[model samples]
Structure formats: structure tokens, C-alpha cells
Target: MFKKNKRISLLNYWTSRYLLTLFVGLAIISFISAAWIRHTTFQNRLEMMEFLADETVYRLTDTSGQNIGPMGSIPGFIGNRDRFTMREIDPILYVVDTEGNIVSSNRPAPPGSAKNVANLLDGEEGTKKITVTNEGQESVQYVVKKKLENNNKVVGWVLVLEKKENLTRVNQAYGQLALLIGALAVLGWCAIYSLSKRLAHPIKQVAEAAKQVQEGNYTFDLPQNNKEEEIYELVTSFKEMANKLEQLEKTRTELLAGVTHELKTPVTSISGLLQAVKDGVVRGQDASEFIQMALVETTKMKTMVGDLLAFNQFAVDAIPVKVENINVNQLIRDAVAQWEVMQDDETVKIQMDFLVKSVDVQADVVRTQQIVTNLLTNAKQAMQGGIVTITLMEKEDAVLINVSDTGRGIAQEEQAFIFERFYRGENKKYAVRGLGLGLSLSKMMAQSIGGDLRLIDSNSSGTCFEITLKKATTL
Candidate 1:
């Protein structure tokens, strides 16, 4: 079993981390933008108030034809005038002369603003300026001052009182908006968490499956994910690998049992025969025959062990093929000829059908011969006495060699598993004398040489097995 990590899982960590970053960034931006809007509204309000006051003073002086002086009732003229039409920030106008006495007033100043006015009059101030005065908890006011000058000498001042109502309204609206955005951010955090969990679900399943596999539980099923290509591929590949492992484990168990049976039969026979001879259970000639039979059994056991080793070599890719272009037709002919000399069944007839002569393919000569020999042997063993036919032909970009037998065909249920190692069918009436490794070994060798071996047809008539090899273009 794999050691579990003690830290937080990736899903939780990233979900919380990213959501925090998102809301924090939104908060910072909102703060800056709201502050900027309030400040901008305040400045613009001051400018508008200054413009209105200047315009009013200009009209009074123009109407009087330069006769209006600082002593005149300026407040009466200005107060009787209609109100200005500015919306963003409304203001009250206050005017004072060089002696600091109020010259005119459109509206009374908010308390505590008179000191600000006096400070302005006492200084050698510039012609135009704006300042802020806080009236404790009652209100805030922005003051715009315009110095009225006659030939650069201070005559009086135009004071504009722009209250903070518009600015305050804008800030209140921004506060509400901020609340709404914060609410959305909370909802977004939930969404992010769900998305992270959805993404992590499949990964967690795979991890659990892997742990089960490590504990030798190959039957565990992994959840499938078809939408994500990379994840799907990973899951499919792991399934295939697990299936292979399961099959190999089963084959190993069967191999051990089959090997034990095969070895024990021969060893027991030899041991019994030798014991019988030593006990004088047979005469000298019979004893000699028993000894010869024992030698044959030993030889057969040796061959079985050798076959097991060869199959193991194929499994481990230890058998290197020296590949070269060769005439496949000639190879098949030579293999058939060798089998013909070895067959002692007089009732069996062999036929050869070569559709295209001189067909060439890239193959290892020895492994190719071995493949043909194994197939022919299997065909011959399938029947007590029947016809075995070898056919060779060319396919598009490939070559095909089929070995067919005229005998009782392999069972339909067993065809799929015929090439699996040690997979013996129940049909034991004409069982051949060997472990069921010949077909499996032949199939592996064919694949090693970039070829394939498969049952083309199997029925009451016969069974035909086809071999496909890569065609050599150079030849």
C-alpha cells in the first residue's frame, strides 16, 4: 500500500487559495475606484461653485457701470437673484471685503466656517483657491475663494460654500455596490470549490485504483472519464495493464501445475521402472526395454523443460531475430518437406497450394521455420488420419500462409482462448502428448517478427489458421 500524504489535498488548497486571491483583488480595486470618484466629485463641485459666484459678481458690477463698490448692499442684490442650477454639489455663497466684513451672503455659512474666512482675509493669498472645513459631526463643507482685484489691489472676495451632500450620496451608492460585489464573490467561491472537486474526483478514483492494484486486487474497477482525453487515455491504459497482469498471474499458476504434472509423470515412470528392474520383475531383455522406455521419458521431459525455457525467452524478449528478406514460399516448402519426412501416419495425405511463387518477406529464417513447424505439428495432431494442406499467397503489402487440417474443428467456445498459454480444451479424446505451449509460443514468435497468427475458420469441416507477415518491397 502507498503511504498517504498527511497534508491537505490539492483540491481544497487550490480552491481556498484562488478564491481568497480573487476577492482580495476585487476589494483593493473597489476601494481605489470609490475613493477616486468621491475625490473627483468634490473637486468638480468646488469648480462649479467658484464659476457661479464669479458670474454673479460680474453681472452686478457690469449692471452698475463700475459704480458698485464694497460698501453697497451686495448681499441684497445677490440674495434676490434666482438660485444656480448645479446638481453634483450645491453650495451657499459668502462674500467678504478687504476689511474682512461680510460684503454679501447668498446663504448663511455653516458654523465654524467663518474662521476659515478670516484666515483667508488675513493672508497675502493668491487670487483663487479652494479649501475644506469640517463642521464636527453636523456636515462637511468645501470653500472656494475668488479674490476680487482692482489693478492688482485686493477689493473683496467671493466665497463659495459647496456642501458634501453629492459626494456623500455617491459614497453611499458605492458602498451598496461594494456590498453586492462582495455577495457575488461569496457565490463565486462556492462555484470554484465545486469545480475543483469535480476535477479532482476522477484523479482520486485513479489513485484509489492504483492502491488497490498495489495490494494485488486487480479486479477493482476505475471510474471512466471520456470527456478529458488525457485522463481517458490514462484510465484506459491502466485498465489494459491490469487485465494483462491478471491474465499473466492466472497463466503462471496454470504453468506451475502443468509443469508439475508433466515432470512428475515421467520421473515417476522412470523411478518405478528402475525399481521394478532392480526387484527382478522382468527378464534381462524386458529390463533393457524398460530402461530404453525410461530414457525416452527422460528425453521427453528434457524437451518439455526446453520448450518452457524457450517460451520464457519469448516472453522476456530475450530471443533476438536476425531479420532478412527471404522467399516465404521456399521457407514454407522446406518446412513442409521436413515434416513430411518425420510423419509416420500412412493414412494422412499432405497437399501444398502455392498461388504466387517467389513471394518475399522480411523475417527471421529460424523463427519463421519454427512457426510453420509448430502449426503443421498442431494440424497433424488434430486428426488420426486426414489431409493437411499448406497454402501460401500474397496480400496487399503483406504475405499470408495458412495451414489447414481436415479433421474435427476446434470447439467454438475454445477458439478465442486457443493461443493462451496452458489453455487446454476439454476435448481430450485425441489429446497430443505435450503441454499446451506450442500455439502460444508460435503466436508470440509470429508477433515478434512483425507478423500475426490467427484462426481464420473453425467448424465441422476443418480449422484454418492464417499467418501474416510484412512484405519486403526490395525483393
Candidate 2:
């Protein structure tokens, strides 16, 4: 398998290449091997003939004036003459003399053969060559020879006829071995390529899955039935991760749907209630009730519109920042003062613990207050009949704040999507007077000012929203 950064790569280029290389390599090897074997056999046979040539030269000298062994009678005159032949290896061997007197007894012809070495007994020695026949009736050629000499003196000449049939057998054997080796090499190459392709198959699956995901098809299923358990494990983990992301996406879309319906409810209600009041269908105190209902609906509309607009503003590329240093404790107190005025809370309690003295941070004051205000409002809504705790602290290089609510805690599955725009929990409804953009906008705003907002902890102990900001630089 091939991979980069632990992700499988899709490329595979070895399949065709290995097969071709194997074929070429085998062909070259076989060609070399065949040539070597043939050369070795030819050299061994030729060496044996050369050794026999030395013995034949000795016999020509030792026999002196008469013929003996494989040679015919030596001549004392000079001119062209016929030679004698005997069957030895294949076609036969020839013996020609200085004067070319080929004796019948020295070079014996096959039984009942017509030639008796009679015409070859006396002929020319200065003619430089000689010829002999094996089956004279059939005119079958036996051997031909030219004069050979070592120095100024003339030495005997040799002519050995080779059968065409023996050569054909050697050629056939070499060809067969070469073909067999070639076949084996082809089969081996096929096996290697098949193995490489099979091993690389898992990578193909991973690549395909990635492509499907890119195309917005998140429901891709990995091949778990693969024999390699490690690949199966990798695919299983990928599927699980993708499924979780898909579910979180679905939740966010659901939240957006809820926000849209929430806005529509208020706009529709206000349009109806105000229309009745304006038309005088309700009079005096009844008219006032209708107006109040319309007011309540208008307030809900304002909250939804505000949250959405604020979230969108952070997402834009426009730069409208005006950063400055300010005491975070004072900043929170001022924000809480506005929230306190919005709702009278004699029945409920709100508290601020300024643990740090003069905790300062560098920020765009308006956006920083928006973040603090959003967290405070969210806590306030949750703790309708309970207590809300807000804290500000100064660390070494940053200021931190935490807001805690004694109301309903966030669910585990919903926590991951909490900072995504328009993502709300399952328990949330269109009547909640929130567009689900507050936390999302707050997180984005904090990040823009070199800060972050995150859930510190959430459970039955209540949810905590933690904020971190860079400590304000001292002059």
C-alpha cells in the first residue's frame, strides 16, 4: 500500500511495468544462456578434433614411404590426383598424399562400396587440392581437402564431413530449453503483477471513498470483508469519523430550519396582531392587549434578527476593527448592567466574581462586549428561575472569564456543534426566541480579537462558557 500523511494514495504504476520488464529480462537471459551453451559445446568438439589432428600428423611421419592407419599411400611424384575416404564420424574422413596416391588398404571403404581407391593411387601433388566420394554410385560427397603446411615444407591436409542431421538435433535442443525458460519467466511475471495489484487494492478503496466524500456522498461504505485486518481497521475508523461529521451536519441544518421557523412565527404573529389593533377590531384595553402581544412578537423578531446579523458580520471579510485596552472586570460589569435592566430579577439571582484586580485585555471593545453579553444572556435564559455566576480573572499573559448556569446542561452529542451557526440542541424549539447564532457569533468574535470561547465543562453541574483574551499591553 502507498500513502502520504497516513492517507492512502490512489496512484498505481507498477502493474504493466513489472510484466514487461520480466519478459524482457527473461528473453535476454535465455538468449545469453543459449549462446553460452552452444559455444561451449562447439568449442569442446572442435578441441577434440584438433587433438586428433596432432595424432594424424604423427602417423603421416611415422609411416614414412608406405601407407598405414587412416591415410592412403604417399606419392613420390607431383601433380593433381584423387584422394581416398573412410567412414569415421558421420559423412567420413579423407586422406590425401603429397603426390595424392590414395591406397585402398590404408583408407578402407565401406563393405561392397564401389570405389577401391584405384583412381586415387596416383595423381598430381602440385595441384594444391583433392576430392573423394563416399557412395560412388549415388555420387554422395565424402570430403574435400586443400594442401596444408607448417613452414616451407608441406604438411598433410584434413577434410572431415559433418552430417546435416546431427546439427539439426543440437539446434532443436537449444531452442526447446530457451522456450521453456521463456515460458517460466512469463508465468512468474504474471504472478508478480497480480500480487502487486491485489496488495494495492486497499489503497484504491480508500481513494474511492475520499472521492465520494468530496462529491458530497458521505454514505460511502468501506470494504470490511478484505483479508487484511489492518486495512479493514483503517477503513472502519474512517467510516465512523465520517458518519459522526455527517450527523453533526444534519443537526446544524435542523437548527437552521428551527431558526427560520422561529423568525416566521414572530413576523406572522405581529402582522396579524397589529393589523387587528390598527383596524380597531379591539378597542381601548383590548386594543392595548393586542398591541402588547404585537410588542412581544416584535421583541422576538429583534432578537432573531440581531443574532443572525451579528453572526454574519463576523463571517464577512470587511475590516472595521477599532482595538484598544480596557479593564475586563469593568467591561463585564457594564455588560451585566444592561442585561440586569432588561429583566428584573428579584426572584432569581445573578452574581459576578471579579477574582482579578484590574484584569485588562487588548480588543475591539464593542465586539468584546458582544461576546460577554452573549454568554451572559445565554446563561440568563437558561437560569430562568435559578442563579447565574460570572467570573473574570487575570493570568500571566491573558485574561479569562467563565459564565456558569444552574439550568439545563448541554447534551454530549450536541457539544461538538455548539459553535456552528444555527446549531441548537434537540430540546430547542422555534418558540425559544433565539436564532441559535449567539454562541457561534461569540466564538467567531473572540477569535477575531485573538481570543477563544469554549465550553469549560457541561453536565448536571451546569454548563460553563469560558473565554480567553490576550492580556492588554502596558504603556
Q: Please report, in order, the local distance difference test score of every candidate based on alpha carbons.
A: 0.76, 0.65
Point out the worst 10-residue segment of candidate 1 by lDDT. Answer: 122-131
User: Predicted candidate 1: what Cα RMSD to the true structure?
Assistant: 8.0
Best by lDDT: 1
**Candidate 2 C-alpha lDDT tens digits along 345-422:** 554477889954566788888887788777767766666577888888777899888888897887887777788777
TM-score of candidate 2 to 2 decimals? 0.55
User: Positional deviation of 266 in candidate 2, in angstroms?
Assistant: 1.6
Once superposed on the true structure, which residue ranges of model 1 sit more than 4 Å away at CA?
Answer: 1-7, 13-177, 199-206, 209-213, 216-247, 274-280, 284-292, 314-320, 346-357, 379-433, 447-468, 473-475
TM-score of each: 0.60, 0.55
Off by over 4 Å in 2: 1-11, 14-202, 211-217, 223-241, 248-259, 346-348
Residue 419 accuracy (lDDT) in model 2: 84
Mark the 10 consecutive residues where model 2 has the least summed lDDT: 77-86
Alpha carbon lDDT of residue 471, candidate 2?
89
